[model samples]
Target: MDSLATTLLSTNLPPTDLQRDSVRQLILNYQKDVLDLRSQYRGRTSPLDVMARREHALQSIAAWKVVLSPVRRLPFEILGEIFVFCVVPSLRSRSTSADDPREPPILMSHVCALWRNVALNTPRLWSDLIFLFSKSLPKRGTVPILEDLIHPSTPHALRTYIDSGAFSVSDAPDILQQLIAIPEFASRVQTLHLKMGTRHLEDLLYDPPPVFLHLETLRLDICIGRRQEFVGRILKFLDSPTLRRLTIRCTYWEDAFCISLAPHFPWAQLVNLDLDVELKAAELVRILTQCVNLRQCGLFSLPDHKPRRYFEICTLPTLETLVIKGWEHTYWLFEIFRFPNLTLLDLVLGKWPTEALQVTPTFTLTHLALHCTYDDTEDGLALVLRFLAQSPMIESLQLNDIHGIGLIEGLTYAPSDNPVLLPRLEILWISIASWGDAAETVLRDGGEGLVQMIESRLHPDLRPSCAPAFAELWEFGFKCWKPKFSVSVQERLANLEEDGVLTWWE
Candidate 1:
């Protein structure tokens, strides 16, 4: 039987009729034998006997798979690259627990001896550090863990985020020494993010900031202490020629403090800046004027702080995206800048004045987003509608508010007065959160308003002209916190969604 099986296995040509009949007989006999074996096992007194046999078979298959795995054939260099991609960027700057099961570098090393060796040798895999201090600074015990996480031989630059805000300078001395103890750690930092208290920052600023020659991105969420007097300019102290992206958020106890940037700060190389701290309008424009190659800027102007001069128009030829928040007059701010190539504008304002729309620059805008606390007043809705009508170039619109009800009302109410609003608009995203007892009112009002808007823009007979309001709209998104819309309204939206004209989300 074995000889016949080997002969059949070796043969490439079709078997003769006699040989086919012999092979079929052999196969039937083999199947019968297997069935008999199964029956014998089924009659055993214990189920463990069957399970043991199954486990043995599975183990054999698993062993064979491990031996034949395609990944095992990859060269160490390629395998190391795959291992590097598995690591999260934050882990490179912070200290990770030795027993952490979720840490990719540690997890990958534990898979097998070969993988452990490759991970240990790969310098880039251990290059990112993320440290989140909850109550105290990292201690002496963490030093060895940090040393083991990075490749000693490779001078790979590190990306790090160190949050030592929970500790004061007095309590963090040991950990601070442990961090800068390694000369390579300081020199190799390419991306640095610090969320530390004022004492620590002052102490850090005392020494000219670490010479992060390779640094490209920096974010500082400095928590202000009682100290208001500055020993030196924080921005000017840090020097990184390659730095391009910077975000600074200053928090003082409970209040937000104004962050002042030094004149000689690395404005020339910066391409992106997001400042959550308050700044005087004139100071903002002056800082921006020096950022000649700036591509994106997000600023939160000081509340109720009037600008030094309103007539000066800041020219940012390279600016393409701008986000302004907490500004009273969105239009006045727009007039203060000449954005010839600006394509995207995001406004989180307390008011959207219609006067701003009339004076807004002539450049075409492709995307516009508005977030403010609005009421059910007709004026609130009218201004938004008028704003949309004046800005004929907008293709995408997003509106959100605390009540969520007024947004849809504003959108629906606008088209009744201005039938030609947003003729070129293609995408609309509306998000409404529950407003306690007014949740139902929001749903009812917002639902009716949405239905009216859709019908006016979509239904052929209801549309006023060949150029329908939002005629080019191919996407509509509605998000309601407490979704309790009428059945009729829901059905209409569902039908439109089914036709692939809109989508509804709850």
Candidate 2:
């Protein structure tokens, strides 16, 4: 029977009619022999017992096949890499729950003995520990399960996000104490984000701060109920030699009382700083003087207050990006500081300041963004044009919350004796809020002016002779909060988009 089976396997096609009949007869004979053996066994064994034995043999074969599978033979190192890829996405997702059953680390360990061993042995799979501290602890038994998975020998980084808004003021201390009790918490923490009420912050002042030897980033979001004198203590707690990035945001107080309290931080070593707290001109100047090595800085609001005394101009040679959001008095920044290496400047202002048109000529800026909170004014176009003229090297420009018609007309290229406004421009994004009294007239005129401006920069025939001096305008975006553009304008713009000359977004 074994030889017959081998012969049948070698045949690549279906058997002939005679061959089928012979095979059928052979099967019947084998069945008869099996039945005779069962009858011979009598009450000692039955057909049901024989069937159970067959099922057991099949199961055994399947088990052996799984053991010999190609994936099962993969090297331990290769399997470890695959496991890292599987768990990284879940780790980065903000919504992933701590006790989620489908979390990669938990699910991978529960698969089988081999997988559990692999997951536990892979250090990277267990490297990042994110704890969300809220009103209550996570689901019961989650802490124990995590404790079992994490080993002391594995080098890991910890990220703790504390939200004290949901907890009562009385419960704040207990919640913070529990978080501080985690094994080797301070030594393992690399990033800490805290959103706490003023009461909770005061509670922290009473305890000795734990030294974080490896902290690199810290963010503090404080909701102030009244003026607190614990800013210096909080800064002391966050002092770390390895820290390079910091963010401090204060709510309910726009005065310099909170910021002025803590002026002795390690600002010289910081590389990235973002402050939303209000600051007087002198305080802002003092902070910038110490942050000589800063690469990116953001000031959310600068009160319209000038320095009481003359201060030497501050220069940040390494600063590359500056973001300022303020009212009319923000122009003082340009007059007081010099950013020789600055490449990008973003401003969100309540009004456009004419003094900003006198921006220093030493900057090698490439990108500029302006967002005005109020309605458009007649002088806004001229102010923007003059600003662009100074930064002739600007490659991208974004103007938001303004009337588009006047600016569009000014940018529309025309053959003249003068040079172009932004000869190196490559990106233009304009957002118009609303057309005032003459909505219909403004929309029609703005639509026409927009098409003209885009074509002059993008169309090969209409491009200026100095087009090769800079990059082609490859991206153009326009948004309006009022009526849609006329159909004719849309068709023209669509044609340009279809031709792949530029990417358009509305």
Candidate 3:
């Protein structure tokens, strides 16, 4: 019978009519014999036993299907890498809940036996944890799930976020107690992002911090209702030797300077610093002097009154990227220091200087982003163009919330014969928010000035001598709102897009 079955399978061509009929008859005869045998023993076999055998057969088939699945063939390492990609974003953002089905690691583990086994063993997938301590303690009952997140076997450095921003006093203690008790949890944390409220701040600040030997990045945002009490006390307990990135923001007050200047903060080794505090020019200059190795720095909403005494100039030798965010009176802070190696500058200014300003020609700036506010006037555009003319090496320029339509016009009417304001600007991004009424009103020109600026830069005459579109530029981006686009302007822009000169979205 086996030989006959093999012979039938081996034959590639269809069997003759007689051969097919014979094979069908043989199969029918086999079925009849099996039924007859079952009938003879039907009464002898127990009904329960028969049902159990059938269930066993079905389970065997299901198991075989799983074994033969193509996904099962993937090596554990490759499968683990796919799991990392799935959960990395969730871990970074801390948006997904513990039981959220969207979480890749959790979803992958529940797929099948093989996947569950692989996910459990892959330590890196379980290393990043987001524990939000709120009133409900949503994750309190899921200790087993939390264990899976911080797997015992996974020796990877943990990136942990403890958010108590929404927690009430009554609920925070329970979660904080539970989290702090986890054996070896704090010591393994390499990147810690803590957002603490008033009550949580009181509890955590008094306690000793865990040894974060491997910590590299620390983002601390504290908003205490009673700032005066904590202002005098320093929370400089967390000092990691390998720490390179530090971001600190205090919503209640500008007491970050007090905490940061402490000897235990390890500012000297930092490579990236993002400080959102209202500090004087002298105070900020004092902090910059310590961060010798800082490569990127952001100073937000800093208010400094120019002192009568001569303030020594602070030089940031290693700084490459700097962001200065302020309203009208804050532009003077830029003059305090000479950033010799700074390549990128992001300015969010409410008021811009109209007069010609001196920029250190020694510094080679390649990228500049200007985020304009409603307070900015039309002449501010000309002032910006003048600054660009000085820093001719700038390759990328981005204008966000730009209030004036004359910005592009200002650059167009430059007096030079080859009037390319930004000679090296390869990318230009202009964004006008829907809320900016002044911008939307003047933009009724149907974006003619924008078209002209792009045309001048892309023109054959300006291409060879000045900054050509070495790469395609994002000439314009209308984020949420659309301006009144005229037919002629749209048609012209469409042609440029087709020729691979520029791209815009509304």
Candidate 4:
């Protein structure tokens, strides 16, 4: 017989410590006892004794092997990454990775001695700690589901959310209870996202977790309740020195500035701040003054105030972009006397100036976006046309208006015959401007005809007699309202990359 031992080894999984001594000893004993029994029955007279001994040895081996191989060991780093993969948003009754049938590292224990040692020493393999509590559980039955898959050295990042939409405090107590019981849990959360109903916000504000240290991105979506307390708690949490992005939506308070934040607090390091609120003029101004390093800011539902000539030179001025919506022109447009470095300005007008105001921007404004409710009259449009024709640096402009500039009105050519303005403007938008409204006044014809006229005037052989589809006269803005930083821009940016206009990494 061609070594029955070789056939047996091929049929079974390698032996692990759990089955090491036992399986090895059984195999060895079978070799000797069965051979002896066979030898005694050499004449084939006592075949029963040999057959019985072989059967007993095989039975012992199978019984010992079954229970021996369930858990596995892995290298510290490999196990760390593996455990990280297991963590995710939790739901009730089922595991977060139930859909992923890939055998978890847990199977390594069933392999052999070498594999078990690797699986046991890896700290990262045991760090994902999750508690899943759901309303579907039996009335009197409660079980705490916990999992920890963390490396002792690697910092942890956790994200948890409670859809208190359908949950009552009585039903979703596990979320808060777990948090309160384990204070260390907050320290491990580097990226925190909490979205819950109005009822639980009160509890958070009263004795909230100080979870801001070392935080990088914070997104909070809470239903309105006890607005002042909620706002205060937010300011309290912002004491974090490491915060980079802050997003708050759907104002829960009567006014944006009622809750005060410490200006000197190390919270001003944030790069992005988005506020959706109806704030008093002073309060809005307060934010602009304090967060001098803020790179991006969005404000909606602005306060209605007289355009005051407030020109206090900002001390820590590095602002690059400002977007103001629901603007009540009761405030002065040129009053923004100190944006020496501002590159882009987006204003949504609720009201307009009583008259066309001659304005000279201090900085080289490259892009300007206007959401207009009022149309600049012939003279008003003339003032705007003159400003654009003079700006040597502006390259793009977007104007969204409800009313239209008059036809055959606001005419001021640069140099009579070759009078084409906004030479640098590459992209033009007339989202709200009607061709019929401004006939020969703005541009001789509608935008299309005007573009041709502008191109004809571009120094005869600037590009060796090459004419573009149209001239870069009026690159206008459109009211294409959509979510911020959405997927739509991804395609737009991709096209720009193909055109070689912008570097991808930059």
lDDT of 1 by residue, 254-328 (tens): 555455667567686889887876665666667777888988887765445437665567777887677777655
On residues 1-506, what C-alpha lDDT tens digit does candidate 2 reach at each position? Answer: 45544544333223445655655666555556556555655655456776665455455445333433457557777887898887655333544443346776667777766677778788777665544444454433224444554462167676555555453534444444545555566777777777776677676667777778788888888866446555556777778888888888877644445355367888899898888876667888888889999998888867676688998877899997777775655777777888889887777645546665565532488777777664445455545555665786775566676654444444543333343356555555566654443344445664554544543543334333222221122123234422233465356446646853223122
Off by over 4 Å in 3: 1-67, 90-92, 97-113, 138-153, 169-183, 228-234, 253-264, 307-309, 354-356, 359-363, 374-378, 408-418, 421-423, 433-450, 453-506
Compute the lDDT for candidate 1: 0.59
- Rank by TM-score, descending? 1, 3, 2, 4
Q: What would the TM-scores of all predictions be?
A: 0.70, 0.68, 0.69, 0.55
Per-residue lDDT for 3-34 in model 4, tens only? 43343344333445644665567656766776
Q: Model 3 Cα displacement at 447 (Å)? A: 4.4
**Model 1: per-residue Cα lDDT at residue 97:** 36
Candidate 4 regions exceeding 4 Å error are 1-185, 252-267, 306-316, 328-337, 349-362, 376-380, 386-391, 402-423, 433-447, 450-506
Better of 2 and 4 by lDDT: 2
lDDT of 2 at 196: 72
Error of 1 at 210 (Å): 3.0
Deviation of model 3 at 103, angstroms: 6.4
Clash pairs, candidate 3, are none
Greater TM-score among 1 and 3 belongs to: 1
Worst 10 residues of 4 by lDDT: 477-486
RMSD of 4: 12.2
Best TM-score among the predictions, by candidate number: 1
* Candidate 2 colliding pairs, count: 0
